[model samples]
Target chain A: MKFSISRSQFIKTLNDVQRAIASKATIPILTGLKIAVSETGVTLTGSDADISIEATITQSDEKAQLLIEEPGNIVLPARFFGEIVKRLPEDQMTLTVGEGFQTTITSGTSSFNLNGLDANGYPHLPEIDAENKLTLPADILKQIISQTVIAVSNQESRPILTGVHILVKDNQLLAVATDSHRLSQRKLEINNGQGLEYDVIIPGKSLTELSKIITDDLEEVDLRITENQVLFTAGPIKFYSRLLEGNYPDTDRLIPHDATTTIEFNTQKLLASVERASLLSHASQNNVVRLVLDPEAKEGTIYSNSPELGNVQESLAFENLTGEKLDISFNPDYMKDALRSFGPTDIKVAFTSALRPFTLVPSEDEENFIQLITPVRTF
Target chain B: MKFSISRSQFIKTLNDVQRAIASKATIPILTGLKIAVSETGVTLTGSDADISIEATITQSDEKAQLLIEEPGNIVLPARFFGEIVKRLPEDQMTLTVGEGFQTTITSGTSSFNLNGLDANGYPHLPEIDAENKLTLPADILKQIISQTVIAVSNQESRPILTGVHILVKDNQLLAVATDSHRLSQRKLEINNGQGLEYDVIIPGKSLTELSKIITDDLEEVDLRITENQVLFTAGPIKFYSRLLEGNYPDTDRLIPHDATTTIEFNTQKLLASVERASLLSHASQNNVVRLVLDPEAKEGTIYSNSPELGNVQESLAFENLTGEKLDISFNPDYMKDALRSFGPTDIKVAFTSALRPFTLVPSEDEENFIQLITPVRTF
Candidate 1:
């Protein structure tokens, strides 16, 4: 195989595929990047068994400026190859494989000779026999993944909770995740998913990598799902992730619909206050901050203290306070994450009781998106 | 004690003093910042026993906007106090200490009550009883520290080698450091240093911290040395570092005056090539790269290889070549550090033999600054 291409263009695609490659793969060959050079284009593949990424640079790509002298396939150490390409002396770098597995990489007066592996040992891409394809805007798809993935459990105790449960039915797409302590659910109205029902649980880590590759430059992404593998096509890149096996817990029943008290606060302002309160709480053993709301007195405050250190209290500026007065305590880190997903909008928070789960939703669109948190019994 | 100061102004002085405060101090009180509020200004001090830094914010300073309501003093947890001050909600914050060393900090609606210690328990700054004072430009002082500190030995086997030997004699200030394998020396001509001879060894760690606080805003820093302590006063900040109590080794005889082979190359280009070669050497057992120079052919090339990975070779772009053909091996990391110290200038490298030490000096000013490295004997 022999080819020379623009370093920047090649680096961009290399970075995207690198996201799926693990430094320590159980299979030795999985750490190598598989490159297939054909008559018209070059395809680069990186995989970590569970997730695989493939990108194609066609001959017609103007920015790539690809020149192919021969056609062949080989696998090279992904990390070392990447580092050498980044430090190459010129704008263009060439890769040539001659006799045996001796591959030579050259740019300007610098030359690197690497031992390549047989590409036949690398696993092939997962094939999906499904014919139906669903399409969604890149931005909206990224939002759904981020909002729900935050609540996914990092603990391996419950393997099923490590993924976000995605469901599409009745022209509406719903994504939800719960770590038993807190749950987040996001909904989007799909114009073409009507009369079709599909349920799958995608690992939070896979979705995170997929969201990063789905940049603003991509207008829309096409998704195809089979029994075990799901593929997302964005521009010249294809992302594939294996679905988690097992049924997700019923988190829908955990969110409380009734509330004893409700208050609306600017997401950014309250986020800052929670951050400050968390500083003291993080120094404490429980890592919980208290919120005391007095509807009749028209005031609210957050209090947190560390036994050996000191205490902090901030008077909260709240709006639309109603119902009975209440006192609640919860893990500030969870609240911080849920608040960040709401961005700078005003969010209405409802408390069922001191020990029950509370819910927070955007004031403008309450029915579409919601984040629920189970409060601690500080008394 | 009670006073309100602009948060930004207070933060600047706080950051400077915080450099001296170590998170894990042998003395608990040493971890707290000593703040003395007087009728004229507020003085903040931080110390880790060996080094102490104090910065004052006067009431007359426009940017400080310090309002002194009362005169008193106290010591508060340096790390926690600095973190709180950075996240305060307003442009200005007020700090007040009541009876029994109870401190109150407030900004906007947020209030923090911290446990404060008695100022009388804090150790006093060392009294350097020196009448004579020498001054140097802040930029030049910073440059001298950066150039030589890189060669200071980090090994604890010989604690005395962890400092840079500084000598001021005959209107010239010279600084040099070495880890036995490599050495760096810098000299500066001082007009007022004549008739004064002083020699001391300052810890490399102290010089690094002093270099950071000696920013471009200050014109000159006044230096005073007496007994075992050295004081550097720059504007409102006073930095004190304890001098090592031992004699430094004589490095004059180690630098070779004659050379069998000589070559000159641009510092930046050589540094880039060395960085590339080090990537492969770092993966190898010996961590060494070989440079083959052919004066007859007017060529030089660097080669490095890893038994498990690959090998890389770069043809060097050099200027003057009036030396015998030779192949030498050296630690690329040491070479990288020496090349970086020269920046982007053309440097002349003098080699005595394949096993002996080599020297590098800027072509423009060869007498003032020089760097030397010992080559590895590769069979």
Candidate 2:
């Protein structure tokens, strides 16, 4: 490939595609990045059998600084190419592929000649029917992914639970994740998804990587789903993730609809209190922290005690308390994660009983998101 | 014991001593920090059998905010205590040790009760004779330690080589370290130890930890050496490190006096070029890079080639090249390290021959420090 491009733009595109490069691939070529230069621009592709990413730089783009001297295709080792491009001494670099797949990259006083593989040996991107297409702001997808991904089960015993269950129907997109201990559900209204519903489970790992690559610049992202894979197009970058095979458990029935006790507190204040209470508990085996709500006192106490280490108790000030006094214990880490993603000034914490799952909702946006955490029997 | 101290000051002192605490200590008591509170103030100590560090906070120091209500001594788990003190919600925390060594730490609306062990189980610091003592500014000691420590051998095959050999005699302080392939030596004129001379080897790891605890506030640090241990007192912190036993190799004869090829180049420029050249070479078996200097052409080229991957060549511009045409291969990482530690606008690289070790010295202050790197034979 004979092309001179702005080093900054090339580096950005390389990073986007590298997200799919496997650290250890069964097919050796999958570890390499495919670079194709044409009259239009250059396209970089990386795939790890399951996930694939492609990023394009066009000559018409002002920041691309692209000059097409020749059109060619080659594959370079992803890691070596990444390191060299990042450390190139100049703002612009030129790449020219010679006979026998020898590629030379020159920038400033530095020159690198790398052994490239034949691009024909690399697999092509899968062609998926774009009948079920949905368009949403990149930031909205990024937020929903982050809010629910953390609750996905990390254990391999249940492969289905390792993926976030995403459902779209009636113009609303719902994302839910659970490890059976804690569950998080987020809902957002999206356009162009009406009457065309898709119920697919995307591996939490892929969504996590996608969230990192997606910028928060409010650009619209087009999502297309196939029977086996889903494609996301953000700006000039295209990301594809394979769907997890199996039926996701119905988690809607698990969320408690009624509460016996509920209290409203500042999100930050409650988060800090739980974090402090978790200090000693995290060092213990159970990692449990208790929440003692006293309606008469108009305050709640977060307490944790580890027999070998010590005990920690923090008083959390609340705006209001209702229902009967309640005492419940749950894993502090789950509560911390749920509280961190709540986007509101205050959060309402509701408890059904000491042994049942509790629900936390942002007071300002109660209808959109709900996080449920099963309480541990500390007694 | 009962006392309330400034949280920030307490946290700083805790961090300073915690560096000596072992991640998994052989002696269970050593995993805990010994905290002693008295009328004067509080003292915290951490030890890992080989090195011990103690930091004291005095009531007279206005920053301490220490109010001693009672006197007592106890040991608390180092990691837990550190985390709690750092995350406390108030500017000041009150610590009280009650019956059975149950300790309570209170700050704002938070309270933590930690199980404490009897302080009598902690090991006592080794007493070192002060007959041979040298005093210097903390910043100077810090600089000398950092400059030479990186060259110390990390392998345990030669335990003595893992320590930096320090010599103070004739109003001069000298520090030298080497790993058989590269050597770094730094010298400074001092006022103390005019007639007293002591040669001791301090473990590089110990010196590295000491360097972090010692601040650059111009405070004087008193260093005392004994038969088996060395003690450093910087401000309110006392650091003790076990000396490495064995004779240090005589590295003075290893430094060449004359050079047939010498070139001066900007330290930063050469460092960047060498770092870039090392990228591919570092992944290869030999980690070698060739330097071809042509005095007639007034330019030098750094080239590295790997048969399996690719090749990289960089042309370096130098201010002056007064040397015969030379082609030599060496480890670029070694050169990068030597260049990074040199403090000057320009550095002079001197070579006696292709096989012998070369010396890199600061062009401005050539007498104070010298770094030697042995070249690897690429043929």
The most accurate candidate by DockQ is 1
TM-score of chain B of each: 0.99, 0.97
CA displacement after TM-score superposition, residue A15 of candidate 1 (Å): 0.8
Question: Which residue ranges in model 1 land beyond 4 Å of their true spot?
Answer: none
lDDT of 1 by residue, B1-379 (tens): 9999999999999999999999889999999999999999999999998889999999999998899999899999999889889887888999999988988899999999888999999999999888888899998999999999999999989888999999999899999999999999999999976477889999999999999899888899999998799999988999999998888999999999999999999999999899989889998999999999999998999999998888999999999988688899999999999999888899999998899999999999999999999999999
* Candidate 1 clashing pairs, residues 3+ apart or interchain: none
CAPRI verdict on model 1? medium
TM-score of each: 0.99, 0.97
Q: Residue A153 in candidate 1 has what lDDT?
A: 97
DockQ for every model, please: 0.80, 0.76
- lDDT, candidate 2, A236-288, per-residue tens: 88899999999999998998889899999888888888888888898888888
In model 2, what is the error at residue A333, expressed in angstroms? Answer: 1.3
Q: How close to the true structure is residue A127 of candidate 2, measured as C-alpha lDDT?
A: 89
Task: List, residue by residue over B198-258, the lDDT tens digit for candidate 2.
Answer: 8999999999999998776648899998889999998889999999999999999999999
RMSD of model 1 against the true structure: 1.2
List each model's interface RMSD. Answer: 0.9, 1.1
Maximum-TM-score candidate? 1
